[model samples]
Target: MLTYSRDEIAAYLDGVVDLEPTPDAAGLLDGVAEELHALDRRPGEVVLVALANGAALLRCFFGVLLAGGVPALVPPGTPTGRIREIADRIGARTLITTGHPADPPGRQLGPVQVETLTGVLPQRHEPGHVVILTSGTSGVASGCLHRFSSLTRNAARHARSVGLRADDTILVNLPLYFSYALVAQALAGLVTGARLVIAGPPFTPAAYWTAVREHAVTSSSVTPYMVRGLVAADWRPPPSLRMLTVGGESLDPATAGAVLDRSPGLEFYLTYGLTEAGPRVSTLAAHREPRRRLGTVGRPLDGVRVALRDPGPDGVGELLVTSDTVLRRKVGVAEGRVGDCLVGPDQIATGDLFLLDDDGYLHFRGRLSDFVVTGGTKVSLASVRRIANALPNVIASATRTYQAHDGTRFDLDLYLYEADPVVAEEVRRELRRQLVRAEWPSRIRTLSLRDLGHK
Candidate 1:
């Protein structure tokens, strides 16, 4: 069942999957799959798809699966040279793209074009693998290897946990390349037979509201950055939006309160996950118990178990995750744990600090690496960034620790996006008021969004 036959896809797509108002989605997917089959696609060869979010991307996705090939997905804007480099690095023989049509030109499926490269490494049998690229801040990218069955199962669990129904319209505005948008949003919508409204990124309040109102979206998800944008613009969710989920970063209580205040009836879920753990570990229904559990990331999903390793007296330690759906491995220029083969069978050390409460809720403390010793006191850089980003004027924040010029100790440097002098001063006053002396940033710099390289 890892790969579906034409008949299976036809049966499933007839009534189960409704992507936009596009006609003959099944027919288009069939055409793509048949085209790949005729293009000499080997049963277990790897294929790369770098396309934007749309019906065409979905068609190519299932088409590769139906053609009995493993599909690796990357951002649609990835350059042709970079794609070929990735293909060579990952041994992918075929590429599905919207550019650089192959010699003798492969058939076009709507806006998608298939290109077969000649210089890929030796073909590998990977029919069960679906590669997802990680958007790490570091300059390198890694493809997370996931089994088709495990990802589907994870999506089903997430959809059920969040009460996604077949009749619901789920809005996917984030980039499809991210696992949060791919596995938890798009694939979850498909697994639950829900209609999907695909939208692109560079998320703005106007575009987000327009999509929700136009499509009558019943379900949607957002990142903390998007949440801040929505709140800053004072945009309100339409009546049709019944459930909203937040991921990608920890949602501060002030911002979460603003969202909840605007839409009292909406179900707001605060979730925590990384790409390595099949991208979803826990989700908290904050709207259900906003007064009691506003800061926690809720409990684990049905099949996932979370524990703290070597917890201190305060029950804070590095968090570890165990689940059947954890990633098999990472490939091609990955850094950190998986690159070192530190991930064990059905379990991974999350490298994040957390405190499991008596009620089983997981409260995220910070990343283990984000902490630095300053003046004989441990300081969490993530905390400083979180507090600064919580301010209304600050669009985004970043923190770095630099050794003193005198080589005495480490000093903290903070960068804020589009903050004025008044706002920066307020942030300084608030940090001193709320945080301990060691957690304060030694220097604060204000820069525009363009200067910070953010959208």
Candidate 2:
């Protein structure tokens, strides 16, 4: 049985738990719940929420859930048209936001009605569903649906497995819309009765460390992009920080080594998951392992089963997962708009390729969909991207396979975003040193930050 309930989560955050710049979580949650209840939204109805990171956003999320209305969270800057398209496809009639221009009370966008929160009233509670959006880098984003019970269940199991405690203070730096931030960090903190320190906007390395030091934050989550930024800034974890969780992308050896060297007492956790599986499938606890594995994503989480399908000679194959936490169905894609349509089976085939080691660690090779065949040789785009991103001054990279007009042979095209001429030359040098001749990119192009997707 779980020790904490959603109703009691706000109570646990009685004091000034959230760090400076964000409102008190408990008060914000109550206010947002009051507003949601005033709307009189029906159970299971979808509500699109486009807000920036702060206490109000968190409150609105839980408030909608408590009001018996499904909440779909998107980034604050998502275009109004895109927001309407997502809401329409999800059958959502209400849109809640902070920045977008709306009428005095509300504005009509096609079938959706946009409204901003006003004064808070009395408290009321109800249960509803949650809709988490995919990164949508492929032009259209998919929405993964989950019940409130599924989130709390996995969160409780995760808290126990990870040794989360009520005394621990957690820092939430990632965007709340991402499943990793929502379930693994925010919800986990609520389940464990831990003090959540919400980091404010302009999320830079300096700001991250400042919050960690000021709040005595015990644990925090980060991505490879953030890791690179921290290392570039030469930022070191303070003594108060006990654990640093890395996900969203593979962590390179150099960055990991730098972090470990700077904070010898700090533990680094490398986790793996998709939005489909309640966003948490496996975790590699730093303390449990003797040494950090270079490219492995660790073992499966508790109650989750991972199996390989039709592995090659190297024992690499598609990873299939079966868990109660997996999404029941995902929204479908229509033309370019995503529609709320239920589609699924019992097991989810994660498009990622992996190889299980004798020690029971799962090593991530790359995505099966991103595999490129050139001159009859198969190459992993993930491997290429990892290698290129590790180079000095290279922010991010994307690779695609191109074939000649006659389709005689395939060539690899590598786009290195945010690299200057000097950095591009260095990248080439590193590529020659790290990759084989067949894996070398046929064409290399440098792009600005705007050209690449933010990880």
Candidate 3:
């Protein structure tokens, strides 16, 4: 069971938590909490948080929670117009951010009250919890609502199951807006009384390694791109580093192997989940049978149940998960009656296709929406992207089906990020060698990271 309370978290961070390039994070958290309580914001009220990663972000997040307001964390670099849109979509009337000229104090930023926190004001209820926005990769972004009790219910068990220690120092460089960073990195570190290290933006490979070596950082969270960058730089970590977790996307077998090869003594955790599942459902601990289960994302986390729905002949099916952490979409009443109200369904259909082996390991195939049929053959866009990303200098790839204006045949369109002409040719050649003719991409276009909506 998880024991996470506001008081407990405050006590845990009383003197231990450290935010680099800043002083006394614990004192800052207390002061921010106090300032938020001064707002007299009622419980269940919506507040938009648009602060960058550092002491201010942490302070404001916990402050809103402690003040009994539902806080929605927006990405650091979100534009003013989009921030207003998000706040309006969520019915938020209050916006909290760092003091910027655009967001003047005592002035309304669009339709919301702009409350700037220059630093912790002074020092400071809780049915309403957190609101996490989806990546909006598909289209319109939706908010995933999570109760504070539900989010922290299994946090302690999760930390223990993953071998996080109180003495360990966790380095988190990911955007704090995402659930992965909020729950897995910040909350987990605080709950376990671990020393939290926050790295600022522009997380280059050199800065990451420098932080790790300088702070003797023991654990850190990473994405596939970050891992690829580390491997490309041939950077070897210090002995103090013990755990490295990879998630937010599928970890290719080659990338996983390369990570393990470089850090033989380090424990690599390949985790899998969506934002709705409090962002983590399963983790493959590399210390146990490291190479044997390179492709599998391992079993479910403690207190979480996993089952397959509609298994195919090959046993692949949609992954269904039941956990206390699953978010229930909030339904509002219209015209004196509730419309299509659900009693909080026990299981969430992950919309992810997976196959569980007899040994109980789960292999992620791809999202059900990511599969496309070309020439009567089903091809996984994720599979194609994985293959394309394996090519050298390829940052990332996205695949979709396209058709000519006057053509009948459906063709695969592959978008490669940060790939030069030579790298694009190599990707095409490699894809031809690895995939069937029907599954080969019809068009491969190189694109900038901005073109793909990545920062």
Candidate 4:
């Protein structure tokens, strides 16, 4: 319930967002809200910021909010058609991209170039300006318009929880659109007045290390992919790094250990949550006392709650979330989280399944809907897949597919790779034993595991 006033959020900027056109921005933070208010004719207006760097998007985000407009900071890699669809679906009249200003705004585009954006507008939590959508990785692009306060509240609470200060320089690797990557690195930096350094494009390893060295970043946001990359490269993490937060996808235990081995003093943590819930609902402190929970997603943070519902005497049902940080509702879309809690006392039913141990640590299970009932009893394919994956040099993945032969849902496809066929066959047999009798797969095909390496 901590609401930000006027545009206190934008004034929180620490470094240039490094836009494509690059605004000669020095101290533009002063009267931005007022400036936009002077020209803005509507409230709750949405601004589509297409800035390159995370801070760039944030600048426009704060600019829009300060001006009384909701800022939907667009992420990188958005296709043009999707942008137009979103704009039309939301009835957006103004677009706040980079580049030269225009009257009619030229043409419609869902995919935008950062170097092409320009202009600022009034702020409001109205219908638009606020960012929408949690994980853009899902099918069809969408958004969840969050109040500036919600984003700010997370930053403030996180800074306090992590002991972040104004002197910290957050190294930015993930896009600002990724709620986890954006919130932990960009927003947290702004809230505490820390320097910002954008990480490189996805496949660029050198650029990442270069940024760390040049900017002297003390903290960073990352995922399992980056951790594996550092391990593969045998990276020597700069001693300047105080902490690194990883999420979006589960970080394999092996990769986590490898990362720690590479960088002795660097602190690592696993965060869990999605876009619909303002990114992080839980976090493991960097210096968590118990050393680190091997397969746990940690506990809920301030303003968030996690609960479990038992399906029966046999199984755990769902992981529930209740939070003000959770998005009220998604605009211009359907079939997602609707008006908070869908059932029970929990405000949000995370499709992801989980179980709380006697120790209070929550262990992640597979998606509830992902369970496959082959004979009579239902089996979690995720568990089966995880087991198959545990075999040395063997990786496993499962896909729930509809069969034309039986016209029934089945977890028929399980993709696994092992460099040697001898080992692959061993994996298939092990899977048969690991999975229940009813849970045995219909087909087990073997192929080259090198291409799609690890799941």
Candidate 5:
């Protein structure tokens, strides 16, 4: 099964989760877990944790697992209405939220407020299942049900991959709701008995620098957006920083180069995964082959395998991951029952396109839906969006593949946010410099702040 043994799992589930404060974290977590267990209970019941990213939220998160209940995590500051909707969708037994509850009879447990929902039958699942929400870029967000042991196993694997140790302090600036942050960062930190520093939702260069320095963070994870932000801000990693991991978006070679140039000693690992696979598929040790193999997301972790589903002539295909840690099933999906989104047992169709090279590395092409056939040529919307978003005046960008109204030919449309005439011209100039003719967007549409707001 590759899952942790009973004693090994207990080492983490019952062990002290080291946090920034270092001393009081254990006692506080125990108190919260004890108080949480004292409440009305049901076996295999699902509990919704809608708290922000901090010790309190993590305390509650582990508290649920310790108290023998399932936890469905939502982004901190998710709207109350939305939280309730997810609760109903998942058939949760209780809602654990921050701040005072509007209704009476809600019990206050330390910093969190718990409101029990009446008559909503809790969803059925095997014991120790944890639900993490998907990004929902393609459709409605679904809760991926993963066995807690599998998640910890994945975390342990990832921790070993990154060489995490007990003396290391892992900085989790990303929100806890994200599987990358939850499993790869938070749970991985716990698995290794590493100290964790919960830092940001509103990430700034100053705040990030302060966190790294103050905590002497040895390892941390960031998205491509954060990588760009840090590079643009001329961020210099502190001497204590030893390892940095990048995921959640494609890290272009140029961006990766810039990050390495800034901190030559840092071990940067580029990773790839989805919510369906317990969130970590592979990781490239960029520090080893930073320039030569910057394009690949490395090989699958130990006990994990990757297959190309229906590869085309060019060898790109939707990536399928086979691992013991793949989600058991999806909850809160449209089907209103478990297993609606199950593609196969112990396997998941990642829905992301990739190329498996002869040397056993996976090169991420783009999302399966992000590629479009235009003018007999396959064009990548993800590539188009990446190019447009790199322009100076572009705040954000999107791409669309469409056919001419008369069905004459297919073309790509590019949308750039907050672009003026000069910016549009700059984009065209840059596109010409970076892309070939067929790959170019047929139309360049400049969208203003107000226009985007209306949408």
Candidate 6:
């Protein structure tokens, strides 16, 4: 288990790294932990952190853990409805945040902290619980249980894989609530004594570049959607960046090409992992980056093993993972690994099915349960999604020909038979060229789950 100490790094940052204006890492961690200790002394004996970006906010995050108290990071910008849900789920008597919301200060969740970048908050905790809430594809959530020690162990492995050095500055664009950001970026940097350059606020192209150059951000893990936005804004990241990793989902090849084109010196990676697996899992070797077209996420990392379950006796099924950094198990479940592929796995059977070529590179075939059944034929939904995305006018796509029979259930596919007048023909043409006739949809359709947000 790792505990963060910012002394030498603090000296290095002030004496060499940031040089001008930067927060003191040691003072910040100590203060935050101390404050949480004080807060624990209050009547409730429990407090929940729900802050946006602020120096104090960051401190509060670590402080809650240091104080040995449970801290639930309300993913920044979570809706008011979600805020209420989080408060209720955690049964928090006090919810902490940097500023008050526009609403009537939320009845049951009280007075926001309204962060001031003042002196450090105190350190406190004796170890109890750590919680992270994750949702289903349909958006229902279950609380994930973790100990602070589990987070530190995961961070140790993450630092080794990322080659952490005091000189490294990692651009953290993912939300702190995202386990990827916490384990792979924030905790990985803090535990290894490296600097983290936080940057989710205005999410602007200029703000991103400013952090990159100003902090000398050497590494970052970014999403493909964010990359597309930056590309649209006519921006390329600074070449000073040494490492780049993409995660959360597969990155489309077109966007990956645009990013690699800009930074000739950057070592790009496509990593795949989840919160259940202690966050750090397999990462593609930077050298294999040229192979992105196959849409391979990456190979497993140190202590992480990723193997595809045999499809029949000879092929692919859902991916099965096992590792030292893997989750011991999950809470609030019963006989549900099949009940929901997303739940009950230290060993995640990634419902996003895939196949290993003779060479061993993994290729995605949509969700396992999502295969469309047409009369008697089964079509891989992801293959159809890929075919649809390739066709012009198809922004994004999914397949639910099997689920379409029920009217109230309302699941749909990517391309519609009646979509763009020209698109239907174009998609049919592309699918025929790439897929067997058996893969063709009996009825093509457009995406309808706008409720599930993704760019």
The best candidate by TM-score is 1
For all candidates in order, the CA lDDT equals 0.72, 0.66, 0.65, 0.58, 0.71, 0.55
Q: Native-vs-model 3 lDDT?
A: 0.65
Q: Pairs clashing in candidate 1?
A: none
In model 6, the worst 10-residue window by lDDT is 114-123
Q: Which residue segments of model 2 deviate by more than 4 Å?
A: 1-7, 13-16, 19-40, 103-127, 137-141, 332-345, 370-455
Q: What lDDT does model 2 reach? A: 0.66
Residue 270 error, candidate 1, Å: 0.8
Give one digit per residue, the lDDT tens place, for model 2 in 1-455: 12345568556444325554433334545555565566676566667788766566776677667666678887777655455556555566566675666545674322223574232121212345687875331112347777767887777766766677888888887778878888887888777778888775546888898889988999888876678778889988888998888877666666777777787777788888777777688887754565557567788888888888889999999888778888766753321212222224546777678998888788988764544434322344555666577676667677655555312233333355644777667767766666645466777777756566655
In terms of TM-score, how similar is model 5 to the real structure? 0.75
Q: What does candidate 5's lDDT look like per residue over 1-455, in tens digits? A: 22334345344544333233322334434555566567756656788887767776776776677666788886655545445556777888687776425355567665566777666677756657788875332122357888898898999998888788988888888878878899998889777888777866767878898888987889989877778778888998999999999877667788888888888889999988777788788989998884868878888898798899899999999888899998877676432222333467688777678999999999988764544434322344555565566666666776655546311133433355645677777767876565534456676666676655645
> What tens digits encode model 1's per-residue C-alpha lDDT throughout 14-74?
4432333344444667776787788877786778887767666677777788777778886
Tell me the tens digit of each residue's lDDT in model 4 across 1-455: 22554345545565443423234443334334444555444767665664556444555566556566666655444444445545655445455564534454544222222221233323345532366543222223346666556766676666665667788877776666667656766767767787776654453557777777777878877766666666778787777878777776565566666666667777777777766666567776644535457567777778887778766554566788887766655665432233243454326677777877666666677664444433322344554555456655455565454533222345543345444667777777766654435456666656554545534
Candidate of highest lDDT: 1
In model 2, what lDDT does residue 393 have? 63
Q: In model 4, what lDDT does residue 226 have?
A: 66
**CA deviation > 4 Å runs, candidate 5:** 1-38, 100-102, 137-141, 334-341, 369-455
Higher-lDDT candidate among 1 and 5?
Answer: 1
Model 6 stretches with alpha carbons more than 4 Å out: 1-47, 99-129, 136-141, 286-294, 310-314, 328-346, 358-360, 368-455
Q: Model 6, 258-301: lDDT tens per residue?
A: 76677677777776666666766666654345644437765556
Q: lDDT of model 4 at residue 349?
A: 74
- The weakest ten consecutive residues by lDDT in model 5 span 405-414
Per-residue CA lDDT of model 3 for 198-316, tens digit only, reads 88655688999888888889989887667777888997878889999877766678878888887878888888866667668888986676587989988889888888889999999
For model 2, state the Cα shift of residue 229 in Å. Answer: 1.7
Residue 3 error for model 5, in Å? 8.9
